[model samples]
Target chain A: MTVEAFLPRDTTALALDADEVAAALLDAGVQLTRNGSRGAFWLEPLLEVKVNGERIAFGPVTVEDIPGLLDSLAAEPADHPRYLGPVEAIPWLAGQQRLTFQRAGLGDPLCLDTYRSLGGFAGLEQALAMSSRQIVQEVKGSGLRGRGGAAFPAGIKWQTVLDTEADQKYVVCNADEGDSGTFADRLLMEADPYQLIEGMAIAGLAVGATRGYVYLRSEYPLAAEVLVAAIERAREAAYLGQDILGSGRAFDITLRIGAGAYICGEETSLLDSLEGKRGMVRVKPPLPAVEGLFGKPTLVHNVLTLAAASTVLAEGAAGYQELGTGRSRGTLTLQLAGNIRHGGLVEVPFGVTLRQLLEDFGGGSLSGRPIRAVQVGGPLGAYLPESQWDMPMDYEAFAEIGAMLGHGGVVVFDDSVDMAQQARFAMEFCALESCGKCTPCRIGSTRGVEVIDRIVNGERRDENLILLEDLCVTMEQGSLCAMGGLTPNPVRSALAYFGEDFG
Target chain B: MSAQPSSKSVIAIIERWKDEPGGLLPLFHDVQAALGYVPPESLSEIAGALNLSRAEVHGVLSFYHDFRTAPAGRHTVQICQAEACQAVGARALAQRATELLGTEFGSTSDDGGVTLEPVYCLGNCACGPSVRVDNRVHGRVDSERLEALLAACRQREEP
Candidate 1:
């Protein structure tokens, strides 16, 4: 019998030399299958072997360890130093409620047979029989909000697109995940791409859209390859092209790549980019749901949100609604990044406190230093001090504390962090990335950076701080999009909590 | 340096994507992929084919950071400068890369071996500080590892 060995083909795993490990395993006469990451990145390149119907885990593996590891596996697998028992029993993965990411890392992501056998297209199959209104109602009943930082009710957007009478409607997947600490979108697309395809197809059926577009970022080359291949496979299987799944209903998806713009992640800006124009934020009078994508109603959702739609349909609305806290009724895909010891993806119910996620799940700072600050959400998110760690990660709770759980990216920083510098960097990033469509974002960001520099240099520090706050207010209230409106989150939070850093 | 594809070939690239809706971005990407960077001369051809003005095409091209008007070095190296990478010493890694490369960000090396650029994020934040050499992304990078990567880029130039 051929011994089966599994290794992740994830970008992170590749960075850790999983390909080299695979070559060594193949040379040792083992049958190797490339799988997706388990999101336990600290244990990557985590290698697994199927023995006696159970996959045993061995991790942080290197090519040098392969000989000894294979030898141990042949002799007594339990005796291996790197062995971590069955893959299912790992506390980091087993403890969380994985709704949207249920099938992540199970098998070859592109294998349609494996995907089908593992209950992949069940949601799409179910959606095939339902009416458009029923589908929208089910999503509404599930309390599913937009996972793309806005926290807007996804069902309402779908309802608007469904109700709007347009000759052409578009389903756009906002795969331009430019958030700093977030990799969930990239991980999901790279790992379980079919789920996103199914979700987009379902959205098309619900909104009477015959065509869909995935506006992906150019940075994720691996995801692009996987998605391109997966889309082709899906089209060949009749799961994406016209007459999807033999229901005689027509729907198809086109993958468009963004040219590296952070603002394109915004819905209107994404639409603008998809139009082959400058990725400038459009005015919000006519929402994308009404007139979008070349003057047609468009259903734009984030990668995670679209993926969650599949889960909501498969498990039923009540099944998904039973998991989370008020107004946030599903598992949040929290990405632990930066100076954390156990940096990875954590999908848990919304009520879990930031402290539990940072300590229990992440194991605190990687440098063994005290945790100074944690930036939740993306670049536009607030920097939270330790005092607010106990707050639950619900959208309402975060909003109550002047924070938003934008994209659920949790970036940790150690005690050595300089909040003032971080604050300045936030402004500098805005200045660099602003689309030049609005004044506050275009001009105020430059001014904000300069004012922060003056304050840090002790040139009329008190006066500069006040000026910085005023500039932030102008950017917050006057800016056209979140790119400018939310620039003050990191800046204000850094100042409010770590005032000493400025002086 | 590689020979720049002639203007006729550039028009063919534009012709391939001109009919598709929202085709300018993809046209630009294909042009840049075939030729190391989007040539400024092709702007008129792209605009003419797509029924857009030269300024319109130029505006879209210049708006994005990815579409450069000139050819890059033999190898392109990008270091993540986002907040997550910053927390894990990406700033120092970037500094080290520039020092070792003898080139600043957004410039090609003296030997034409590498072009250094700062990227916002690579979505590989957990294992960062991340660095991308050409198409492949490597994580948990440090000064020593960056030197080795740059050394390999230089080594390819010797032969």
Candidate 2:
């Protein structure tokens, strides 16, 4: 009898001693294989026994528990207390409608054969058969929008790039996954790098661009290493560079490491940084699709957007189009994080209520306290009170409520959290990360912080509150990019939802 | 101006990337990777090679936080103090860390054992308070874990 155990080599999983567990499993004469996460974070150090091509899960496992688990699995795979039966059948996972993330948490991330076996590269293969126009049309048919918080239509961006004529064009993947509580980009890059590579290659094919780049942040050193290695492997396998799969087209990817700056995640700033300049935001009359990246037309997309493009091509527009609600198509890879019990990557289709994700998927707070607030998106996102938990995780739905589904990162906070402090932090973070491209953001953020500080210190709270609101409006209207523009989201939302905390 | 280790190596680094468009960042990265930090002496060399002014080179170098102006300590410890990490008591952890090291954020220890820096987020938000010791990242780092890590760095310090 052959038994195999798979563990996620992702950043979070490694931090939880998955590496130590892997070593321990090896010492016990158990043949182990490392794979991507199954999104079951609570069960991390999660081991899966593949019996007859079906995976049985065991987890939150320590080195001490390994011997007992191996013994029980040897006797009866289903008899172990730690075993959660069929891996896919788990209610938490089975309920999720994974489209873009279908290949995530599977076999070896780097293996070309493992990828092909699990429906990887099918998108590129399918895309290679179609003309650029047909590919763009198919994407348009899918109704997919940017998963990178902007909610811009992916097909429209592609169409514009395709329409534009330039001697040199580029497809740049925004792998600077800097949003707080978000790890989907990091997870995809580490677990399923080929998907991102294929997506970019497909975009290259569609846009008549031969060169590509993945501008990853320096904070994620592991992701950078994994992506760089994967790009090399892809190049060797003829999946990238010169002529791809005998398709008579040429495209290649380069990995550029970002110096620590949150502003660089902005498309124009990213392009500026890519040109080896200071990562400052640029005024945008010439959209990136028209003029970008060394003054050549460029298509800059977040990692998930490109990954989704790969899936849409592979599964056909209709297959992806069938999953999501309203304007939102396909699954949103929601990153469950912070002060949560079952926090991990949960990729579900749009329209799922926060109540469902928080109660059913996240399993409430990690501290076992009542979840008082949730911050959707990043630092720039709103601090939603429990009353808004029933709100759907849709782009338009979130916007309607004066909130956002920015990058689909849901950070839970328990009742013990101070809303005033969180609000102050919003201003402080803006003051720290603002690129100083515009005055409203540069000066207003510092002033906003002081105003909030005055309110916190109980110095004419009513007057200061009004002043802070007015300041937020000025910054929101005047800032060049989302960095300063959205800083007021958390501050204003906190004021609206948790006003008592201010007093 | 004082002399550099060898002008040939700096020229070689410049020559390698001079043909590639927008190659200054990678050039600086290579220089920093080979040497501990971007030495001030190489600024003129880089400026001449890239055909830019000294102020331009200085602007790029100072704009980024990664390119240290001087040599870093043996170990670089970056603790995440962003919102997600802060939710789980990273501020307290950061304060305790500074107290243990007898230095504040962005400062090297008195013994030059460790340089503690505060990063916004390490992208391990799920399991943070996250800390990066050199290139390796660790999550759920409490005061005890931090003390153990700092002690290890102290032990490895050159006598």
How much is A58 displaced in model 1, in angstroms? 0.6
lDDT of 1 by residue, A1-503 (tens): 68898899988898877888999999989999899887888889999899999999999899999989988876999899899999989888888888888888899999999889888888899899999999999999999999999989999999999999989999999999999999999999988999999999989999999999999999999999999999999999999887988899999999999999999998999999999999999999799999999999999999999999998898899999999998889899999999999999999999999999999999989999999999999999999999999999999999998898999999999989999999999999999999999999999999998999899889998888889989999999999999999999999999999989986
Scoring the B chain of model 2 against the true B chain gives a TM-score of 0.92
**Of the candidates shown, which would achieve the greatest DockQ relative to the real structure?**
1
Give the TM-score (vs. native) of candidate 1: 0.99
Candidate 2 residue pairs that clash? A36-A105
Predicted candidate 2 versus true structure: per-residue lDDT over A1-503, tens digit per residue: 55577877878788778888898888877677788776677677778877777888887777777888888876886677778888888888898888767887887788889999998899999899999999999889999898788989999999999999999999999988888898889988888999999999999999999999999999988888889889999999999999999888999999999988888999999999999888889888799999999998899899999988888998899988898788888888898888888888898888999999999998888888888999999889999988898877899889998899999888888888999999988888888878888998889999998998899899998899889999999989989999989998999999999988986
User: Interface RMSD values for the candidates, listed in order?
Assistant: 0.6, 1.1
lDDT accuracy of residue A23 in candidate 1:
93
lDDT of 2 by residue, B1-159 (tens): 345536676668878886677788888888787776788888887888778898988988888878887888889999998888887888899999899989999999898888999998888887878899998888778889989888888887746
Off by over 4 Å in 2: A76-81, B1-11
